[model samples]
Every structure is written in structure tokens, then in C-alpha cells.
Target: MIENLWLIGIGTGSPLHVTGEGMQALRDAAVILVPTKGAGKDDLAALRHAIVTASGTYAKVIAFEYPVRDPSLPYIERVTAWHDEIALRWQHALKDAIVGGPVALLVWGDPSLYDSTMRIAERLDPLPKIRIVPGITAIQALTAAHAIPLNTLGGPVQITTGRQLRAQGWPSRAETVVVMLDSECSFRTLDPEGLLIWWGAFLGMEEQVLFHGPLAEAADQIEAIRQTARAEHGWIMDTYLLRRT
Candidate 1:
């Protein structure tokens, strides 16, 4: 039988942001898996290392290169195949290192949000007992960095992706919408009249950027900064929230 598997949320790569329960989970793990996204994105892996080092709670940390999905395939098919490969990678890594013991993965932000760690964890052959330790998410970090509440008084908020917003336009009944995983400036497709947008990139990091104004006025600036940042870093994960006035 498989041992315990802890999916610990690390919260925006900041060791200070790790919760007490998450720290305990890390201490309990026999092996910790760190995923590398190749060279240009080595910083992503480095951030995890920094967290581990700062915590001073030594575990048998191992790094493995993450499997890249084929972009040419249909989105759903591509994701499914990618998850399968990742699961296989995890199995191989676990078998080679830890035998049967508690393993931990430092997830960026809260795994319960848009992350796929839970789905992939379920695909394990002999599923291990799973435990989730929640952490601050990008949305939370963004709002906190900007010093604004996530929702208006008595107003509901919708969280969605760039593709959905681009294809379907504003949600029928949502007063506030938070968008993530958007490569394109999907907000450009909106009418932009009387809409307010708060955009942030590299949230909680030293190089973080924040901009907010009427959608029409701030849209271009957001696009420019996003493009420049992507070019500089070769990858960027950003999120934004839109509120209609």
C-alpha cells in the first residue's frame, strides 16, 4: 500500500507565506519533489529551493524536469496527455527514491484553486492518502498587494480564464471577474466603457507591477508591460480582476 502524500501549498514562492500546517507537513515528509521547467524557467525551481533553504527543515529534496505538453494538440487532449506523463514521472521519481513513505510537493499558490495537482494526484496507480495544506493564492496576494477587497459589498465575484472571457465576453450576472492563465490580453476584447480593471504581474515578488484605472485608459499600459515582462522572463503568470461601474 502507498504511504501519505502531502500537497503543500507554498504561496507565491515566499517562505514567509507558508502556513504553520504547511511547515509541519513539510517536516513530516520523507521526500520532497521539486519540478524544474527547463533552463530559462530555472528561476521557478530556484524559488522553491529558496523556500526550502529558508525553512531550514531538511528533507530528502529531489528535482525532476517537468514534462511539457504538446501545444498543437486540442487543449483538453493535450492537458490529459500531459497529466499522464507527469503522473508517470512522479511514480518513477517516488519509486527510485523514497520506496514507501510520505512525499511532499511544494505547490505555487493554493492547490485548491486553478492548479491541476489534485487531478494528477488522483491518477496515481495505487493512490496514496492525500492531504492538502492551503496557502495564500495569487488572487489573495494580488488583492493584498493592492490593498483592496476581492468583492464589493453583497456582490458576488467570478473567477475564470482568459479563453473563456475572450470567447464569451463578460459573464451574464457577474459584477466582478478575476481572470487567470491568460497569455493574451483578453480584456482588450471587452467594450471597456465604464469598466474598472486592477492588473498585477509578479505579485508578491520584488519586481511586481500593479496598474488600475478605467479599462479603456489602463488596457494599453497593461498590454505593454505584460509583453515586456514576458520577453524579459520568457514566461509570466499574471492575473487581473474587472469590476463594472
Candidate 2:
């Protein structure tokens, strides 16, 4: 059984995005687990290694091949199975290191956000004492890069995924809706009238791209840019904020 598991948020791509506490956790970890998303995504794994190195940590780094979900399975079933497999992978990765000391996993954004790390951790046979070392979230990074506040004069802000936005349309009474994990550019399905969008990709990274304008005018351009960027770099993680203008 894993003794202690530290879910450290490494933020987007910058090592500086890791907070002082996260850095210290890295330094203190005996073994760090890094997930490799197969071919064409080596940069993602490399970045984690670089982050660990930057922390000046001599901890042993173990890389595991992340499992791909089955497309045939329904959404909930597929995700549940995927998480189970990931939990099994974590167990296998730490088979020899449980007694070493605290084990750490570098998460891409805050664990409490849309991440499933905590849920995956629970699938472990004997749950380890889990500790979260919070770091900069993508939302924070996005807003900072845009120099915009998340809420509009104390108005409520709703955060949802592209899937939910596409399925539920717009949430009523939401002055601001922040969309994440939207590969489809789901905003295209919206009316776009009186809507303003501030979008950012690879936020907090050197290769970040941003666009802001009326949704009606900027949706197509944003999608085109997203397509080109995804083709150039095997993957892309982006988020956008929509406000009623």
C-alpha cells in the first residue's frame, strides 16, 4: 500500500507556476510518478521531468504509460474504467516504493478543479494519506494573462466543460461562463449575440495564444487557430471566458 501520496499541482507549463510549498513537496518526495501519454506527447512528460529537476530534487522519477479510454464504452462507464486502470497503473508504478517515503504526482492544474486525480487515488486498495499542495490553476493563469477579472462586478460566474455547455446550452442568470476542455469550440453552437469571449491557449506557457472580441466575429478565427496549433503540437489545453455584453 502507498504510505503517503502528495498530489502536487504543477500548474500549466511553467515551473514558476509551482508554488513554494509544491516545490518543497517535490524536494521531500522519495519517488515521483510521471504519466507519459504515449507518442507525439513526449513534451508533456519531459516538462514534468524538467519541473522536478528545477525543484532541485533528487527523487526517483517513475514514468508510466497513461491508459487511453475505450471509445465504445458510454461516457460514465468509460471514465470509470479509465480511472480504475490508472489507479492500477499507479499501484504498479509504486510497487517497490511504498516504503520509501512520500510519493508525489505532478498534476496539471489544481486537483479540485476538473481533475480526476483525487478520485483515482481513492480507487487504491488501501488509500494513502493524501495531501494537496495547491498551485496556480488554469483559470487564474488565463485571467492573469488577459488582465481580466473572473467575475463582473460581483456577478456570478459559472464554470463548465465544453461538453456540458454544448448539452445544456447556457446556464440561466450566469453573467460569466468559463469553458474548459472544449476541443470543439462549442461556443460556435451559441447564438453569439451580445456575447464577448476572451480565450487563451497554453496559458502561462511561452507558446500561449489569446483572442478577444465579440463571439460572433471571433469564433471562427479562434477555431482556426486552435486547429493549426493542435496540428503543430500534438495536443492543446485551452479555456475561454464568455460574458454577456
Candidate 3:
């Protein structure tokens, strides 16, 4: 029976982003779960392995194939089913690895932030005690790469996904917004006038890319860069911050 489940955030694609606490958790874990999401994402899988190796963890690192969401199902239903399948895989992997006392899953960015790891963990029967080891987030990485503050002075900041931005447009009365998990370049859906954008891809990693300027001027360029990077790498994780100029 699993006694402890650790959702350790490793940050966006960088071993260096693993915190001292996160490293210690790796060392203490009995089994570490690494997930591979099939073709076009081998780099991500390798990076996870590299992180575990770099941490010098003696724990057993078990790699599992991640379940792909069914495209035919509606978005919410598809994601729900996918998470269920993943939880089952996690159980199988954990049991196969050992009589798990403490198992760690390296999360890409903090588990609390737009990640489904926590939800999947909940699906485990007799839910194990969950612990989260936080790491730097893509938002932090994006802002740091551009040397910009997250919010306008004393103003509220809105953080959302690309889907929401596309479906709902900008949040009302919000001066600043951060977008994550956006593959569609949703910024194009909005009128670029009076907007400034700071965008980054593969943040905190060697192939890191950044672009910033007036949205009207940078939208096309950013989209081009995104397409080129995605074509070359086969997969891309990007985020951007938009503010009213």
C-alpha cells in the first residue's frame, strides 16, 4: 500500500530548476514515476530521466507511457477519462516498482498550477498522504526571461489557459494576463491594438526562446517562431503575458 505520494515540481524542462527540497525528496523516494507521452515528445521524457539522474537519486525510476486523451470525446469528458487511465497506470507502475512507502512524481511546474497530477492522485484508492514540493513556474520563468514584473503596480493579474482566452476573450477590467498551455496562438483572436506581449517557449531550458513587443507587431513573428520551434522539436510548451499598453 502506498503511504506517501509526493508531487514534486521540477519546473519547466530544466534540472537546475529543481529546488534543494525537491532534490531531497528525490533522494528519499522509494519509487519515482517518469511519464512518456509517446512520439514527438521524446525530449520531454529524456529530460525527466536526466533530472532524476542529475539529482543522484538511488530510488527506482519507473517510466510509464502516459495515456492520450481521446479526441472524439468532448474536451471535459476526454480529459476526465484520460486522467482515470493515468491513475490506473500510476498504480500499476508503483506496485511494480515496489511496495511503495513513498513514491514521487516529478511535476512540470507546481502541481497546483494547471496540472492534473493532483487530481489523478486523488483517484487512487485509499489515497496516500500527498506532499507538494514547489518549483519555479513557467509564469515566473517567462517574466524572468523578459525582466518584467508580473503585475502592473498594485493592479490585479489574471492567469488563464489559452482555451479560456479564446473562448471568453480577455478578462474584464484586467490589465495583465498570463496564458499557459496555449498551442493555438490565441492572441491572434484578440485585437492587438494597445496590447503588449511577452512570450517564451521552452523556458528554463537550453532551447529557450523569447519574444516581446507590441502585440500588433509581434503577433505574426511570435506565431512564426512557434511554428518553426514546434516543427523542429515536434512538441512545444509555451506561455505568454499580455498587458494593456
Candidate 4:
């Protein structure tokens, strides 16, 4: 039988953000696979290690370098190929670490939101029974940091990516849009006449930055700050909320 795979959401690099259930999941894991993007991105893996160490889970923690996607390929194809590579990595790591037992991965934010770990896990040859221990998401972190509600009154909200905003423009029927994995600040491509934006980086962390204003006014500052932060940290994960005013 395939071992159980636990996709545990750890939440925004804050130990306090981990749920009790998530901690228990970590404690129960026989092996935990942590992915590092490279030298400059070691903090991502370190944060996972910190949590595991603090939890006193006693699980064998193994760190592996994450495979990079080829940007020249079509976006979907590139992502699919990357996921396949990641699944292979997971299998290799599990084989070396766990004899035949439950394994866990500490996913940033909630695994369901813009996270492909679940999809990659599904590709395992003998699929393991999957369990998701959800944690706080960056969206929730952003809204809480800014003291704003995600939706106005009873209005609807759409969650999307930077690429979609650049290609399709503002979604016609939605009043609010939450954009994630955006490096381009694609809201600048839209007609800012009736739009208000709330952008946040490093949400729920001490280094969090938030800017809220008319899209036109905040776009430049957001871009500048984003560039500076990315250069300083060597990587960034930012999300923004746009509302039609």
C-alpha cells in the first residue's frame, strides 16, 4: 500500500501561523521533504526546518533543491513539466528517507491557494492517501495586516494571477480581484480610472509592506518597493487586491 502523504500548510513563515492540527501532522510524519530554490532562497527551506525543529516532531527532515521551470516554454506546459520534476524529486526523497511510512511537506500558505503540491502529489505512481491540513493564507494575512475586509458588503471576489490580468484586463463582472504570484504588478495594464488597490508583500511577517490607494497613484511605489525587496531578499511572494471604485 502507498504511504499516506500529508500536505501541511505552514502559513507565511510564522511559527504562530501553524495550526495545532498542522503541528500534529508534522509530529506524525515519518519523513518530511523540504525544497530549497538555491543559495539565495535558503530562507524558504530554513523556515520549514525551524518549524519542524521547534515542533520537536522527531521526523527525519530531508532538504532537496527544487527544479526550476524553463521560462521559454508555454506557461502551462512549463508548469506541468516542473510539477512532474517535483513529483520525481519527492519520490526520490521519500525513498531515501522513509522506509515505508507517512511523509509530510510543509507548504507555504494554504495548499489549496495557488499551490500545486497537491497536483504534483497526485502524479505519484502508486498514489498515496492524501490529507491536507489547511493553514492561514497570504490573502488572509494581507487583509488582516491592512485591517480591511476582503469583500465589500455582499459583493463577490475573484482570485487570479498576474498573467490573467495582463491578458484579459479587469474581469468584467467582479467587483474585487485578488492577484497572487504577480511579479509584474499587472494592474498597471488596466484602466485605473475606477480602481482602488491594496497591495502587500511579506504578509504576516515583520517585513510586511502594504500600499493602498488609487491604482494609478500606488502602482509606481508598489513596483519600486517590490523591486527593492526582491533584490534584497533574492525572491518575493506578493499578492494584491483590486476593487472597482
- Tens digits of per-residue lDDT for model 3 on 1-245? 67799999999978989999999999999888899988989889898889888888899878888987899999999999999999999888766455546889999988889998999999999999999999889999899989999999999899999999999999998999999999899999999999999999999999999999999999999999999999998989999999998
All models: lDDT? Answer: 0.88, 0.93, 0.92, 0.88
TM-score of each: 0.97, 0.98, 0.97, 0.97
> Which stretches of model 4 miss by more than 4 angstroms?
none
Q: Pick the candidate with the highest lDDT.
A: 2
List candidate 2 stretches off by more than 4 Å: none
Q: Which ten residues in a row have the lowest lDDT in candidate 3?
A: 92-101
| lDDT tens digits by residue: candidate 1, 1-245 | 33678899988756778988888877777788899998678888988888777666668888877999999999999999999999888887766574446888999999999999999999996888899999889999989988989999999899999999999999988999999999899999999998999999888777788899999999999999999998998888899999999
- Candidate with better lDDT, 1 vs 2: 2
Best by TM-score: 2
lDDT of 2 at 157: 96
Residue by residue across 1-245, what tens digits does model 2's lDDT show? 78799999999888899999999999999999999998888988988999999999988999898999999999999999999999999998877764578989999989989999999999987889999999788999889999999999989999999999999999999999999989899999899999999999988878899999999999999999999999999899999999998
Per-residue lDDT, model 1, residue 59, is: 82
In model 2, what are the clashing residue pairs, if there are any? none
